[model samples]
Target: MSKANAHVVWHPTTVTKADRQRQNGHKSCILWFTGLSGAGKSTLANAVDQQLHERGLKSYVLDGDNIRHGLNRGLGFSTADRKENIRRIAEVAKLFVDAGVIVLTAFISPFREDRELARGLVEPDEFVEIYVKCPLEECERRDPKGLYRKARSGEIAEFTGITSPYEEPLSPELIVESGTQSVEESVQIVLRYLEERGIIPARR
Candidate 1:
């Protein structure tokens, strides 16, 4: 790396919250949903984004599979690739937050260390980790994309909770039990959290 590139100074600009709020009409945050495969992270994230849209909130979802087809195309399932994947996604999410938009990220994020690193890249209170808690058996039963089946059949390598590991969040901001809870109920839980935190206004 060039010394000039490494030694660039950051002259902070005075961009007030009022200015951003006026442009986007709300505060920005990162809603990071983490879990194993087939744990309904993507499903819940999309549902929550739809609810936010209906309530006039500016939000977007950075889904794992979708990202793999584009920004993270070169990444694979290795630990190093997974860390890099989350790092890139965190940077993107930070940009959205700066633009005053709520960014929802749904990824396996199997390692707690990687998740914590992502959180460290953003400002304090800007990231909210939501743990989608579902048992491995239940996740296999649901198997919306049949990924679990492939993992079990030895067709896939380094699958979380089977061939690899899944590190549960020690103190997630929110936990949704997707195995027992209905999708509607899960969405309501997330919405209620956002409303309670004043991220979204309460209904009149």
Candidate 2:
């Protein structure tokens, strides 16, 4: 370590705390949902968001397809692009958290390093990782978007669980078994976890 390499810098900004609080009206956090495609990650995330909304909590969802259409439109399914995509989304999620809005992100992600990097970008309690666990066969059977079929049929390349790989989380904050559990059960589990953590008030 060399002090000569370090430089002090300051950037001026004028945004008051009250202003941000009034704009979002709730504490901000990042709920990172990871799993195989067709594992019900998006479904569970959206359902949890709906429950939070009913409780007057402010939240937004960052989904895979939705982001690819905009912020990550230029990115592809390559390993490098996938990492970059998660990096960009993580940065955006950090911004949303600072703005006091709960951000629910649903992505395969498929790499522990990228997920860890995303977690490192935010404060300790601000990031929550939910593992939507589902067997490969079950995911293929569900095929919510027909991606599994396409990947198997060569219509898609380097798809996770097909030509590529999906690295499961070693230790996730929460686990939702989409294959064996009902959607409502999964939603309730997530809601309970959030409530226990005081992210949201206990349901009435």
Candidate 3:
């Protein structure tokens, strides 16, 4: 171990994750939402979080732009920076899972290696990859933040799905067709999956 690591030791929490899950009446997991820009990842993640909250379930959303303004403010859009950003978010999500909170992260990520790295941090069933599938043409047309326009006009560098590439998840836990489906329909798809997986109780 490195000198810095040798002194650091693992500390166990007195109140275990299972204890918190029992109290919260739901399982804790990470709902990782990956897609290109303008793919509605943040919108869907927030919608899911709201639904979980209304159901008295512990849940929170870690959005890309919001997080960039704070925890990852110093990072840029470079390839290395993007990887680091996802790494940090993954670590934070794992902590939330340990605290028995269902954490949803909305990010482009754009790399299979990075996504798999995030998955490896938790148990097999603890991480759910939700691919927000939308065509490049649709995303550019939508351009909610005008990012695609900027990228197309050469105002931005190394942007995913324009200058850089967005690697789609090969076999995601769920695939939300954001391009074709209504927002409410997409939200229901996610909720149904959670219920079927025993992460949340089914509605009466």
Best by lDDT: 3
lDDT of 1: 0.88
What are the Cα lDDT values of the candidates? 0.88, 0.88, 0.93
- What TM-score goes with each of the models? 0.89, 0.88, 0.92
Residue-level lDDT of model 3, residues 1-204, one tens digit each, is: 454565668554479999999999999999999999999999999999999999999999999656889889899867788889999999999999999999999999899999999999999999999999999999999999999999989999778998888889999999999999988999999999999999999998
Q: Give, for candidate 1, the lowest lDDT window spanning 10 residues.
A: 1-10
- Indicate the worst ten consecutive residues by lDDT in candidate 3: 3-12
C-alpha positional error of residue 188 in candidate 1 after TM-score superposition, expressed in Å: 1.3
- Cα distance off (Å), candidate 1, residue 74: 1.1
What residue runs in model 2 are displaced by over 4 Å at the alpha carbon?
1-13, 16-26
Per-candidate alpha-carbon RMSD to the true structure: 4.6, 5.3, 4.4
Per-residue lDDT of model 1, residues 1-204, tens digit only:
344564667644668655785776677889999998889999999999998899888999999666989999988867788889999998999888887889999999988898898798778778899999999998888888888899889999878999988999999999999989998999999888887887778766
Full ranking by TM-score: 3, 1, 2
Report the Cα lDDT for candidate 3: 0.93
| Candidate 2 clash figure, as a count | 0
Candidate 1's displacement at residue 132, Å, is 0.6
Report the lDDT of model 2 for residue 146. Answer: 95
- Backbone clashes in model 3, listed as residue pairs: none
